[model samples]
Target chain A: MKLRVRHVSRYVFDAPVKRLAQSHRLWPAETQGQSVIQWSVETENAVTGSGFRDGAGDWTQTVTVKGPVSEFTVTAEGLVETSDTSGVLRGHRERVPASAYLTGTRITGLTAELRMAAEAALEGMDAASPLDRAHALARYVSDHVVFAPNRTEPATTAAEALEGGEGVCQDHTHVLIALAHAADIPARYVTGYMLSTEDSQGAEASHAWAELHVHGLGWVGFDAANRCCPNEYYIRLGSGYDASDAAPIRGIVDGATQETLDVSVAVTDSARQSQSQRQQ
Target chain B: MAQADQNFFNEMLNGTDVRAAYENLDRWQANMPSDLRSLKQHEAEQLFRRVGITFAVYGEGGDPERLIPFDMFPRVFTADEWRKLERGIKQRAAALNAFLADVYDGREIIRAGKIPEHIVTRNEAFEKAMVGIRPPMNIWSHIVGIDLVRTGRDQFYVLEDNCRTPSGVSYMLQNREIMMRMFPQLFVENRIAPVDGYASALWRTLASVAPKKCEGEPNIVILTPGQFNSAYYEHSFLADLMGVELVEGQDLFVEGDFCWMKTTEGPQKVDVIYRRIDDAFLDPLCFRPDSMLGIPGLMNVYRSGGVTICSAPGAGVADDKAIYTFVPEMVRFYLGEAPILENVPTYQCAKTDDCKYVLENLEELVVKEVHGSGGYGMLVGPKADKAMIELFRDKIRARPQNYIAQPTLALSTVPTFVEEGIAPRHVDLRPYCLVGEKIELVPGGLTRVALNEGSLVVNSSQGGGVKDTWVLAE
Candidate 1:
């Protein structure tokens, strides 16, 4: 499936700044299952700087804006062709070993409540394979934490979301990661885009999920929010220990300007392009 | 007077007679008048104060900026002794650098079953960000300060390795300056090697490791956490000596994949940063978001080969106490040689047998937290009271993996001037080894002496004093 993704983030500052710098991890990962057709990231009032691929196989580019301007906007648009390999994220170039993901981030640390939930989810299922266990853990997290938007903060841990009994895709991914880790499965948080289909729930361009490293199959993505594995409709951007690390955009402004941010993203299937190319 | 341990080596004395290394100093001290000696002591204190040589001791009641008491008597090492120590320090530093490169890249040490996988994988100090990121020249620890303690005449054991931004080189330099000013004739009689060239050596080492992108003369700067830090004086002093800019996080910015230091003139490209800030506080975007002491995209710039960060991030994993036990194996594995220096016998509480033994011998072994430094969170078994011992026992039982136990060896002593006269006090040496194009070290090191009578702890933060160490020229 060929997917087109557009992400725009606008920041309005109360006061103008002398300098603005941002480091973006917005480029789609180059993987065996996914290929980038064309990708470009642009920003108003900013000039693109140098780019490099990080140890985690994510292309990062620096942008600088020297201005007294009160508003700044970053736009990322890309087209990627993805293939389904049964959710196995193969041929992804990441320097970090699978065992490194066994460690948890502050946002995914296991609390007593999370530990109890993980233990309860795996009770009487010890004999199951690692892959099956990962699926069951994802299902358990989805069931326990109702999908409710804006119910938790960005810094919310898996235990906090589970205790509150409500969170969004990010929280669900965190809870699943905590549970998966408790079951001795190496898991990491993944940020990407999901193309909405007729049979599927309306998918957001910005999506998060958990990927567990299975003993025999490598990393397999499981989206607890959609209750399915990542398929051809999914376009992976980057991965980290948690959502904060995998965030697509991170920056710092020089001046102390009270700012408000708005983000808009759209992930669409390029049906028109496919039909036009076929006719030609 | 407390009896001195017969087993411990006294640097100034051999049984009852003065050692050859201290013979000249001993004669000078005997000839000097007591009034002049006290006057010189007062002059030394005044000089230290005038020069603003003080360390900030946090969590204490009184003035935070207190001078580290300087002993009038200097510690002496013969040329032969210095030669042996130099070789050992170089070997240890090389092995440590190799270990860091291996752990971050191929992890052959772990694969070869030399070290446990969990030890590296589970360690918090092991940074995932550094995995497969080859630093310039593959040198992870550009500056290594190896702590050594002597027990017998020829016995020296490495206590720890300070690979991450080791402080106290300033103290070493300052002590020598004061010693020369107070006693000019003592130096004239003894052929003491000069250590004034260390700053230049350090500058060259940093310049040699500049990223491949640097052209012409690489611009180097010292990245400091600012004035409030305990080692701020050293940072500024070194920068001044090296004729480099002393910059803080706010004084630098990342642009065009390179780091630039904000100057009065304009933005200056920084090719190498001798960062004194910890790894967690070096890049806010990459590590700790709440850290205000780090540049926003410095790590990204470093990853792009836009700049070189000396003593690269994740170097601390090599110096962790739990990993310190494997240095001997690392020496053999990397250098294909035996460790010239010995490692103190350690009991890792993570092991079942070691934990059991540590718990059983709580009063006889010194238990230290694996990640703890500056003599904090350590229980000296012989010195700890019953209540402290019991508390530590519970802590060990709760988290056995966080603690390591070692037998308290009799630390060597140097003759120090107390209120009465010269007396033996425990001392340890920390020689700074520079690693870049090559590994080199100054002849002597910072000799920290426990000021309190019979006290074994010698951390400057814990009220330790420093003595000028003299490495006699052959």
Candidate 2:
């Protein structure tokens, strides 16, 4: 599947801000699961610093807008060709040891409840492989954490989300990551774009998922919200310990003034769009 | 200074015959009357106060600002001993930098099975963000402070290494300044190597590691945590000495690809930042989200090669206590040289055999937290009461990986002017080795002394004092 993605984030300040600086991890990842055909990240009147690939195999750069400015918009426009690798992430270049991801972050820590759930998920599968255990944990999270938007806050932990029984994709990802940790599997939070709903491929598509580092299979994607592993429709961006670290555009405005944000992300299947255009 | 234990070796004496380095010092000590010595001590205190080198004496239960008692008697070292020490310290500093460079990039040592995989990768100080981002000259720790303790005339063991921004270099300079002011004739009589070159060497080191984007003379600034910090005096003093800007987190801002300091003249581009701030508080956008002490986009500038951070962010990984054991191996593997200095035999409590040994011999060993510093959260087995030892034992049993134990060495003592004339006190050395395009080691270093009788710990925060450490010029 060839996916065309456009993500725009606009900021409006009540008063002029002194400056705005943002670190962006907005480029599509280089992996066997997806390959970028074309991509460019831009903001009007902002100087983009030289981009460098990080330890996690993500190319990141800094964008600065010298201020006395009222507003600005950061837009990420890209086209990616993705394939179904049965959720296995191959050809991803990274220097960070798999053990680095074993440590839990503030929002993805394993709790007593998470531990109990993890144990229950693989009760009789004592001899099961790490990949199988990871799958079971994702299934368990899908069953327990109901996908409900606005049910949990940004700072909500996996344990808190699990007990509350209502959360978004982020909560589900965090819960699954916590379970994977309890089962002694390395896992990370993945941020990306997902083209959902086949017939109408163009939809609001900013999404998140979890990747478990199995013993032999390396990193395998597991999306508890979708109740399935990531497929050709998924375009992975970057990964981190949790949601905040993996945020595509982390920005700060220097001023005492209050600011507001407006974001829109649309991902469309290119083949369907071209066919519809030909038919019209 | 403490009353010397019979078992502890006294550096000034060799069976009643004064050591060659102390021959002149012995005459000076014997001639001074008790009243005059106290008067000179009083005068020294006034001198220290006037210079504003006073410390808060953390956990020592004193006034907010109190003097770190200055001993009138100076610690002396011969030219031969200092030469050997300089070589050892320089070798260790080079090896440490090599280890850091390798750990962040190839990690050859771990793959060789010399150091366990988990030890480097699992360390909290080991940062993934630093990987593949090479700083200027491929150096991580520009300034290395290695702590050394002596047990006998020829036996010196490294207690630990401080690869991060280590304090107490100011104390070394101040002690010499005050000593010279009080007793000018003593200095005239003995030829001592000058340590004033340290400031210039440090300045050169900082300049040499300037980012590739820097042209002409690189602009340098010392990034301090601000006035309330314990080492604020040292920061300002270093900046003043080196003739550079002393800046707080808010004093600088990132614009475009560079970091600029807001000066009275206007914005100035900073090529090198000798930051005294910790890694977690250096940049808010990169690490901790709630850190107000960090500039929001400073790390972005650092990462993009717009500026350089001295003793780079993840340099602390090489200085960790657990990592200290493998430094000898690093020296052999990287430098292809044998270790000149010895490491204190340490037992990792995480290993079952070591843990059992440490637990069985809790009375004779000193147990310390792996990440703990500043003389806090440590059990001085010999000095500790029965209750504290039991508490540590239980804590170690609960989490063995958090602790490391070493048998207490009878550290060497130097004669210090006490209420009842000169007495022996345990002392340690911390020499600041500067590495950049060139590695420079000043002859003299900070020598801390334990003020209480029979105490082994010599941390200033624990009521220890300092003395002028003199290395004789040949």
Candidate 3:
């Protein structure tokens, strides 16, 4: 499937931001599952700085703007060809070992409740394969937490999400990753774009999931919020220990008394390519 | 109270006979009048105060900024002695750089089973952000300060390695300056090797590691945390001496894939940053979100080769006390050479047998935190009382992985002027090694003397003082 994605994030401050700097992981991962066709990231009234592929197999770029004026906007547009690989992430160059992912983060640290839930999910299935256990844990997370937008804050931990019993994809990914680690499997949180079939207009596109490193299969993606593994419709951008680390955009504004943020992302199938092929 | 051990090696005296290194100084002292000596001492203190050479002591009730007492007696070293120290310091620096590059890139040492995987992976000093980001010239620690302690005439052991930002080079320079000013005749009589070239050498070392994108002459600046930092004087002093702009985080920004310092005229591209801030506080967007002392996208610029950060982020892992044990192996593995300097025999409390031994010998060992610095969070076993030893035992039992124990060596002493006149005081040396295209160091280093009688701790914050180190010309 060929998908085109456009993501825009704007920040407005009540007072002028003396200085602003931002880091973006907006480019799609170059792996067997996805191939980048073309990608461009730009900012208004800001200068886009150096870009590099980081150790985590993510393309990161820096942006900075000096302003006595208020608003700053970052726009990322890209086209990527993706294929279904049974949710298996392959051929991604990362220097960190699988054991490094087992290190729990502040947001995904396993609580007693998370540990119990993970144990319960794998009960009577001790003889199953690691992949099977990972899938079972994903299912357990999906069933335990209802998908409800605005139910939790960005800093909400897996323990907090489990107690609340409802959260968005971020919370769901954190909970699943916590459980995966509790089961002694290395896991990480992934942030990317998902082409939602229900939203034909391709709005509400930003998504997050969890990836468990199964011994034989390598890293396998699992989306507990959708109760399935990511397919051709998903574009993987980056992975980290938790939501904060995996955030597509991390930034800081200096000398601003107050600031407001707005984000919009759209992912849709490219009709122009299909039309061109039909004409040919 | 404990007393100085008579068996310890004294740098100035051997069985009440002055060593050959101190012969000239001893003769000069005998000829000098007592009133003139006191006058010179007062002049030295006045000069230090006038130059604004002071260190900030946090959490202290008295004045925060206090001058590190300067001793007039110079610690002299023969050319042969200095040659060995120079070679060892260079070898250790090279090995440390090689270790950092390997750990971040391939982990060949870990794979070879020379060092444990968990020790590197689980270490808090091991930054995940620096996993595959190689710095300019593949050198992580551009400047290193290796702490050396002497127990005997030929026995020098590395106590710790400061791969991160090492302070006291400024003190080394200032001590020499004050000595030359107070006693110009002594400098002419004794062919002391010149140390005035360190600032230029440091500037060249930083310039040699500029990013590939830097064109022509690389623009260099010193990034300081601010005046409140304990090492602020060194920061400003180095910057002035190197003839570069001294900037705080607020004075710099990232734009157009490059880091720019906001000059009085406008923004100027910065190619190299001699950063004195810690890694966690170097980039807010990458490492710590709440850090106001760091530029937001500085790490991204660094990873992209836009600006070179001297002593690159994550270099701290190589100096971690737990990892220090593997440096010898690194020397053999990376350089195919034996370590020129010996590491003090260390007992890692994390290991079962080592923990058992450390706990059993708590009264005879000096236990230190793996991550602690500046003589903080340490227990000198011999001086510690029973309750203090017991307290450390409980702390060690709770987190065995965080502690390391070493037998207290009888540190060598130098003759220092005290209230009761010249007496022996324990001392240690910290030589600054600059690594870039090549490893270079001045012959002499900062020799810190414990002011208190019989005290072995030489940290300035713990009532220690500085002395001029003289490497005699051949």
Clashing pairs in 3: A49-B256, A49-B257, A50-B257
Against the true structure, whose lDDT is highest? 2
DockQ (Cα-based) for each candidate: 0.58, 0.65, 0.69
The candidate, 1 or 3, that scores higher on DockQ is 3
Q: Show pairs that collide, candidate 1.
A: none
| Local distance difference test values of all predictions, in order | 0.86, 0.87, 0.87
Model 2: colliding residue pairs: none
**Model 3, range B121-170, lDDT digits (tens) per residue?**
77778888998888889999988999999999889999899998888888
Q: After superposition, how far is residue A220 of candidate 1 from its true place, in Å?
A: 1.3
Write one digit per residue (lDDT tens) for candidate 2, span A1-280: 8999888888899999988888899998778889999999878999777778888999888888888889999889889999999899999999887888887888988788889999999899889888888889999988998887677988999999999998888898999989988988889999988877643221323689999999998999998988888899889999998998888888887888888887787777998853211100
- In angstroms, the error of model 1 at B389 is 9.9
DockQ of 3: 0.69
- Determine the backbone clash count of candidate 3: 3
Judged by DockQ cut-offs, the docking class of candidate 3 is: medium
Q: Assess candidate 3 and give its TM-score to the true structure.
A: 0.90
